[model samples]
Target chain A: MSTQMLTYLFVGLSFALYVGIAIWSRASSTKDFYVAGGGVHPLVNGMATAADWMSAASFISMAGIISFIGRDGSVYLLGWTGGYVLLALLLAPYLRKFGRFTVPDFIGERYYSQTARIVAVICLIFVSFTYVAGQMRGVGIVFSRFLEVEVSTGVIIGMAVVFMYSVLGGMKGITYTQVAQYCVLIFAYMVPAIFISIMITDNPIPQLGFGSEVNDGSGLSVLQKLDGVLLDLGFSAYTEGSKSTIDVFAITAALMFGTAGLPHVLVRFFTVPKVSDARLSAGYALAFIAILYTTAPAVASFARLNLVDTVHNTAYADAPEWFGNWESTGLIAWQDKNNDGIMQYGAGAALSPIKPSFDGNTGVHGERLLSNQPTESTNEVYIDRDIMVLANPEIAGLPGWVIALVAAGGVAAALSTAAGLLLVISSAISHDLLKKTLLPKITEKQELLYARMAAAVAVCIAGLFGIYPPAFVAQVVAFAFGLAAASLFPALLLGIFSKRANKEGAIAGMLVGLVFTFTYIAYFKFVAPELNNTEHWLWGISPEGIGTIGMLLNFAIAISVSRVTAKPPQSVEELVDNIRIPSGAKAATEH
Target chain B: MNSDEHTKQASDVSQIDNQKNYWKANLKLLAKLLVVWFTVSFGCGIILADWLDQFSVFGFKLGFWFAQQGAIYVFVALIFVYARQMKLLDRQFGVGDENDADQESQS
Candidate 1:
């Protein structure tokens, strides 16, 4: 069958499975709605959480980003996965013992203040929305490219599918669906890796394939050949530090802490029965996620080698239809600088033209990369990072069904994460903000109705954002680490560990961290244009890294202010003791 | 003699709940965690990266591999240690499960 037909078949079959599960496992009570009735096996919850955690960012954009940056990409591999370690160790079990349905509840009770709870809610909304926006956009990109639809239409369709399952079954549906998604996405990711590994290194395992001998009798490993080729092409050695080491280190830290603090991810721990289960679940989740995280570097290195080999020193620099195909999508762009009619890996300036060379002379080349794609012929490349996962099969010339499977997997990753994040936002709004705070008298049935309404509304808002995301925003993803690092990480780490963390301190910390980080991002990314591009951003720490600084300030100010304020009282102290002592944990705690 | 035994039992509960020593225990755990988090990330990736890059693993520089892969492996190991230690510490303070091997189910 044609790739298009196969894509439709795969997407349809996967969607059908989710809807079927949602129908079969519709949540009957608020407990089930929130934690799948707290009956999930630890390993099952771990698999679901892994699926929920790995987004389109990890599945698609990550390796592509790595292929471009080479060595710097390891920061992402480390940063994103490292957070899981922190989550498992520092937060997950304690919070699970706290026995709360939402992150805000723990914050509110831990700090003994309503305002603190509200602030955590705000932070949860901010981080989850920023994350959900990217997933929604991913859905659009996958649909438009493979299913032959408008990006906006794709977004709306994806939103509706998520709304149906999540509204009907809440965590119940989302957990099982994510398990399926984990299977689909992992299979989708690994098949191509195995194919490419076999084709290149004669080894089927990506982890070992990276270190094994080169297929050609070159007497050097594939990595060694890669280094030689990259350096020969004016690129830094493939594994050398090309990024500002400080920026790489700071960004990795921010991402790691942010991952640990993200509400939707930590909330998965509550789905298991016991604190010990929470700890064990985390180990299992990491193991499942490792299947892909460990394989990613190998995929990146191989893709970089394949891409360069295809285009470098060849008569057909862009003969592969892959280049033009992705170029039209506006992700990949090549400028014929010096009119050398070749692409080179060098310093950005040497390879860049100050003006567009697409009108064959005076027109723009990079901005609207798709519109003027060297129409009549010479090889000008413009492939996007998101294309890496999708194009992996094609780049290696795998079976057509394998390419279809990739498209399905990308959607699965995006949809699973979107469902998980959307549930957090909706629950926080309806269960925490509305029912608990605004209308405490609402019946359980009525609250369930509003929860469904909240999920639907969130889906609509997310769909809109996916369509017309703001200027200077490179798709809703660029904000993930920054927002999480700034607002959520400090509050979470402090609330549990520090006895002096009072209400005023927690609120002040969150507000200050959020405003400072947000404003800093706005200035560099969006505002500097109107303000004359000033060299004033406190050591050029872009919005992404600004969070690390903001988080530190949050810690300092929170404790400083707390020292001068009232301590949480004797009863609140008792509550803390109770939470830490698992044997005394109650199924329900009213006070 | 019975009255004397009752007084000793009361002292036992007080010792288990002693706020000062509990805080000290929590502090110890925090210090250990910070060391692990800091060493694996800052040490493996940045401060020692240059010197360590002199060594190579699987033809990849040591620092780069640590920055990318080794630190992550260490991080995974750290969590397992943290979990095991916390469980033990909880047991020492009478804060752990009364039944170690028993599992509970809810209706």
Candidate 2:
């Protein structure tokens, strides 16, 4: 069978499986919809959480980004995973003991104010939407690349699949389907990595192969060879980072805090049966996630080495099949700056505009003619970082089946995360906004109907974002993490840890953190892109790292404000005391 | 009647004291574990990465390995340890899940 046939078969089978689970696990009550009846096994919830947490960015773009940036990429590796430590230690168990339907429920109840819940809802919407847009776009990219369909068609199909499961069976359906997705994505990720590892270093384990010597006659280790090659091409050593230490520190901290704060991830713990289950499941989730995280850097190094070996100084017509295949997808392009008819891969940007603007005509060597002016740099290739993982199998000459599996894996990663985010969005709207605040007297059946309706609308909006992606879709992702870290994380922490944190203090802290982080990011990213570098950044903290400072400010302000404000009521204090214990964590309740 | 009231008051005080002790112990455990977490991730992974990278183990740079791999392993271990210890703590304080139904009935 052709590669396309295999891709269709795998993707079709995955979709059918998801739809089947949705039908089998159709939510009968609000409890089933919201928290999967709050009886999910720890291991199952852990795998589902792994699937939800590893979005298209982790699955598709991370390794490629790491390959380009080298040691600086450790910031992402550490930042994304280290947050789980915070989650397991400080947040998950206590929240589970609270036994609420949504995060805002905790905020509303603990702070004893509707205003606080509204603020949390706003923050959740902002973060989830921004993050979901990326996932939707990822779905579109995978569909277009693998299925030979238009991006919009791909997005619509993805939205339909998500709608079928999430709207039908809610969290129960999403959870089981995500377990399947976790298996598909992890297997897809590992297969090519193992193949490449053996091909490059004679070691089957990508993790060990990363540190082992190159299989070729060169006596150099993989890292040493990578460092040498990158430096020879005028790039920084692959083992050394170019980012300033302070900037790296701040960015890592921001991401760590942000990861711990994300609503979709935190909500997963609520599905487990008990407080200890929450803690145990967080450990399992991280262990599952770490498998891919540890393998990514190794994959990055191997792909970089392979790319350079395969393409550098190679004749345009003789370039590997994967190069041209990706080129047609507009992710890879070439220009003959020296008219040498050979491709040059180097450090600097090949085109002045960074992204290639293809012209209608083909060049003398049949390369795509680009309207982009060639830069003074010797680099003559433009490779989109998102293609690294998807193109890896082809680059290494793996079987067509492996390539097809990668396509399915990418779709699974995107769809699973998208479904999780949409669920949170709908729950915030139906449970928090409508039932809790607006229509408190509504019946449970009415509320469930509204939840499904809200999910349907949210899925459509998400699909629209995928089809007509905003110009800032990529840039706004920083907003999601930044806002979550600066606002929700501090508020939740204070509400749990400090009983004196009244409504006034919690409200003030969230607004201050949200507004401050938003202004800083917008100023640097939109207002003055030229001044976004270290010299102009406040205290050597880039906009990406400003969330760390924002988080600190939130902590300080909340603590001080609570000192001045009236102490929380006695009942609220009792609530805090209750959540601290491990027993009596019944199923998540509407009340 | 006076003696009965006094005994009930005494038990209430003891229960409060037990809860307080449990909280204190939980905090102490968290502090110790968090210190180790900080040492592995921020202290070694970031602050001391360059210094530690001066040494290599089995062709892997020590600090880089910590940043990329070792810290994640430690994080997983920490959570499991926390879960196990918290379970024991729950049992010790008579707040284990098995006692949940009993507590609910009394309430």
How do the residues A231-307 of candidate 2 rate in per-residue lDDT, one tens digit apiece? Answer: 99889999888888888899899999999999999999989888888999999999999999999999999999998
Candidate 1 segments exceeding 4 Å error: A315-318, A333-379, A472-476, A529-536, A589-591, B1-12, B18-30, B91-93, B98-107
Give model 2 RMSD, 1 decimal.
2.2
lDDT of 2 by residue, B1-107 (tens): 47857886879978778888999989999999999888998888889999999999868789888887788889889989998998899889976676554544555
Count of backbone collisions in candidate 1: 3
Docking level for model 1: acceptable
lDDT tens digits, residue span A438-490, model 1: 89999888888888889888888888888987543353366667777788788
Q: Which candidate should be chosen as best, given lDDT against the real structure?
A: 2
DockQ of 2: 0.58
For each candidate, give its TM-score against the true structure: 0.90, 0.98
Report, for all candidates in order, the number of backbone clashes. 3, 0
In angstroms and one decimal each, the interface RMSD of every candidate reads 3.1, 2.0
lDDT value, residue A203 of candidate 2: 96
